[model samples]
Target: MRRSRKGQPVTEIFKQLLCFFLHGTSRHLVFFDTLAKDAGYAAVIESESTSMLSSHSVKRFFRSFRWPRIYLFRHLLQRMFLWRLKLEAPDVVILGIDTMVMDNDEAKVRHGVRPTYKRVKGF
Candidate 1:
């Protein structure tokens, strides 16, 4: 299990693997399996995996944790991403924001799907 800077367990790093299969987006399982096998396709930055990552194990684990903490989790993710942006403020020439909506028609995806900026009274 991986951990955040605050030493909190980051289970979603694995759920990312779950979302690949359980969500029925694309041929996620085939893609995952193919990539897991072909060591030559691995990048220099990628350390070798000891064993293949199992989607079923992930599904079982996800059932235990996928509830009630999205508010906290999303904030934690945003804070980490913002911190990275501050540290690596690249040159303006190649800087851009790319918002990707994955393989779904998401017309009414969620309540906060639209971009909004609001000031809160307290930190």
Candidate 2:
């Protein structure tokens, strides 16, 4: 007998996430309504059904997710970057880690303006 409550396959869910990141609109929405309406996302996922990508489902996906998965994904991204550097034989590979900062629109950004080691004078 089928399970009491079946959910969408993991692969399908991941594909949806990937599509959203690649083609979603700039405007921020809790449920990513703009992302769901993306033409590229629709084609890649092989479905144009809004019900399949409902706001509740999207919110549930984020709510039920674990941090360890995100850590693992970050490691994978770094590994890919290193692999590409090796293949291309770059003279130097400078890795930059960025920290998220909350500030007003007047903030100025310049080359080497905000290094990881140096902290901003004013908060």
- Which prediction has the highest TM-score against the true structure? 2
Considering only N, C-alpha and C atoms within 3 Å, which residue pairs clash in candidate 1? none
Put down candidate 2 lDDT per residue, 42-81, tens digits, no spaces. Answer: 7667965553465566677667756887788789999998
Candidate 1 lDDT for residue 47: 29
Q: What tens-digit string does per-residue lDDT give for candidate 1 at 51-86?
A: 344445444444556445666778899999889888
What TM-score fits each model?
A: 0.37, 0.50
Task: Let me know the TM-score candidate 2 reaches against the reference structure.
Answer: 0.50
- Model 1 has an lDDT value of 0.49
